[model samples]
Target: MGKPTGFIEYLREAPTEREPGDRIRDWNEFHNPMPEERLRTQAARCMDCGIPFCHTGMLVSGMASGCPINNLIPEWNDLVYRGLWREALDRLHKTNNFPEFTGRVCPAPCEGSCVLGINNPPVTIKNIEYSIIEKGWEEGWITPKPPAHRTGKKVAIVGSGPAGLAAADQLNRAGHWVTVFERADRPGGLLMYGIPNMKLDKEKIVRRRLDLLEAEGIEFICNTEIGKDLPAEALLKDYDAVLLCTGATKPRDLPIEGRNLNGIHFAMEFLTGNTRAVLDKQPGKDYISAAGKDVVIIGGGDTGTDCVGTSIRHGCKSLVQLEIMPKPPQERAANNPWPEWPKVYKMDYGQEEAAAMFGADPRTYLTTTTKFEGDENGNVKAIHITQVEWTKNDNGQFIPQPIPGTEKVLPAQLVLLAMGFLGPEQPLLDSLGIERDSRSNIKAAHGQFTTSIPGVFAAGDCRRGQSLIVWAINEGRGAARECDRYLMGSTDLP
Candidate 1:
């Protein structure tokens, strides 16, 4: 530890954000970089606990309690405090392959399990992490170091999301030729389009890493679908091993009346189009304009919040977000212990911007959309919503029951359904004759990552369900270790 008593001496401080009203007009990131001295002080707040739980990366009460990738948080914190930045970046890269991405958008669970957070605010871990990696880039220290020798073995990865990229990086480091296949025009499956520009800059961060990967002898084939464009059998015949990292993208739908209305759309359909327009600097037919329209977004998750932010950028007239679950307590409840993931109210960036623009939070909890009402010509005009109560029924199962006389109609010209995904689309899995679990996710053991068939593996959201980017990287690295072991009868990858 740089300073044993630094935690007691300094208070936690984070980077400043641009005012919501000012940032909404542009698509650039909102965060302003913190001064170096203050960032060091923030890192000095790391307590260096005897048993640091921040790096545990385990699930507590079915919710993430620490860094999923098990980032070496304490080592980097001490390194930054001592002005040893290059060393700090090395410590960060030891566990996390992409600190920049996780630092920007990941909800930091490591801070939740911080030892100091039992009383005072936790250290500004995420901000410090972002600072370390960005500094590495500025100093020209982060560059490609290709493997020394080739093992004469090749691996085929399906999907170019975080999981696929991590696995590809690891396999390449082990001297194996790696190729990634992406269906989209871009290499980053979700990072390129699923997320908006303001949260993560595409050209600055995403493309920079892709270029490095290419320089390191990794091949990426864009606009190529494994099952549809290229048959799954091709990879089995061409490559020595195949690892499936295709994400779970099958969106859950609300099968109610007027679902086929012209104005109603899935959240991804709206988000993906908006990002394409921003990057290409031109609007196409697929672009859905929220300009001068009342928008109603169902499912109050990150996707819905993204819709809210995107709509505000498009100059929406009014907006509201609907959630079926009851609002969480503003503070941690009694049952939520110190190390458990606290279920508390949080105002994300999109909600903060909406509150600043509309003078109120846009989320309406405990409310569900019953049906969508459309006007003539099949354009959605309004939505039927009802308040509900969660109660234990006779069979001791929790169910949502609609409260009588709680129905109301809200005017909405554009309806975006942001409910979460169910599982991975089955076309590719079925074509390959891969087995799946009861949830329809590809069947693969957690640590082993081996599928039912030999020489084929699965990882990330395709194996598990929809999860965080950190978890995707973790699974990707784990799968690579197992795959390398199977191919050479022994492995050096971690």
Candidate 2:
């Protein structure tokens, strides 16, 4: 606490965003940097609570109440307020391996539990975090520092997503050799392809980290799928230990009528193609385009939001997002008390853009897509939707039953299915002979990274099923520690 009265003196302020009209014209990030002095003032809003729940990373009533990686929020907020930027960056790096990525896209659970948020607006934690990390990069404070000693124990991490990267970083720092294998041409799994370029600039953030990891003596083998391109037995034989971080990549499909129409696509296909085109500077003529097309996005979650943003960038003619869940309450109910208010309504970046353009939130809650209708050319032309209500069935399970007369037909030139993922595809897991849990996630107990096969372990989304980037990093780090301990009698990594 640099200033005892800082919280009172400063009101919450965040980075300004590009105007909707102006930003939608380009795929660049929409956020405008807050002035340094104003950012310092924003940082001053940290309350220095007796118990800073913002960094605790616990789930209160099944909702995340803080940073999942246990980020040291107050300490860095104080440092930033005092203009000790390098120190703030140091404090941030202690807990989080990639603040730039989290700062840009992560929904700030820490702010929801902030003590200041109970009465006043929460501190601008996300903005301060983004500023600190960007500053760290600009000042050349971040660089590769490979471990001085080599333990000669080799560890192979499958999947170059957040969890795999985190584990590799930790294991490498502990002096063990680390190699990350990625199926995609690029190293970052979802972060590289699944997430669009506007929210997270691939080169500036994702590839930048990959470069640093490479310089730190972590080897990345891109386009080398474990099961297909490279045999699982080779990994088992070449490396002392294997850590599976393969993420849940299989998209959940809407298996209703006309599902295979030409213009209908999984959300990832549209997103990944858009990103690859941007990076490669060679968007093909046949590429999926939303420009001037009436678009309907199914499933309203982070992925759906991303679809909205990307479609906006593509100059979509009209956009609508459908959700099966009921609309969340505008304000936290009595049942959702302090440190449990994140579920309350808040417009994300995409929704904000949509509202600015469409004059309303694009979401149609308590609605589900019944079927798709295709035209003579085998292109999707419309979707049949129905409103549904949740009711407890005879078995005491909440089931969605469609309303009798709420069906509607909406014209759509392009339909994006963003219904989330089922689990990791089983082909690779099957090839490795790795066991899986009931959820089809790689069968490994939490904090115990070892797979049924000796010298093989699993972590990240593949092990835990689809999850957040912060959780991926946490799992990666944990798996790295356990792998190190398994390889070398002990590990110094935290």
TM-score of each: 0.99, 0.97
Highest lDDT: give the candidate number: 1
Tens digit of per-residue lDDT, candidate 2, span 1-494: 87778888877777788888788787787777888899888887787788998988887886678888999999999999899999999999988889999998888888888998887889888889999999999999999999999989998988888898889989999998888899888899888988888889898788898899899999988988888888989999998999889888888998998999888989999998888888888795436889999999998889999999999988899999999998888877778888984567778888988999989999999998889999999989999999999999999999999998999999999999999998899998888778889988888888788889987888888887777888888898889888988998887787
- Kindly list the per-residue Cα lDDT of model 1 for residues 126-170, writing each as its tens digit: 999999999999999999999999999999999999999999999
CA displacement after TM-score superposition, residue 234 of candidate 1 (Å)? 0.6
Cα lDDT of candidate 1 equals: 0.93
Cα deviation of 362, candidate 2, in Å? 1.3
lDDT for position 68 in model 2: 88
Candidate 2, clashing residue pairs?
A: none
Model 1 alpha-carbon miss at residue 313, Å: 0.1
Q: Please report the TM-score between candidate 1 and the true structure.
A: 0.99
Judged by whole-model lDDT over C-alpha atoms, candidate 2 comes out at: 0.88
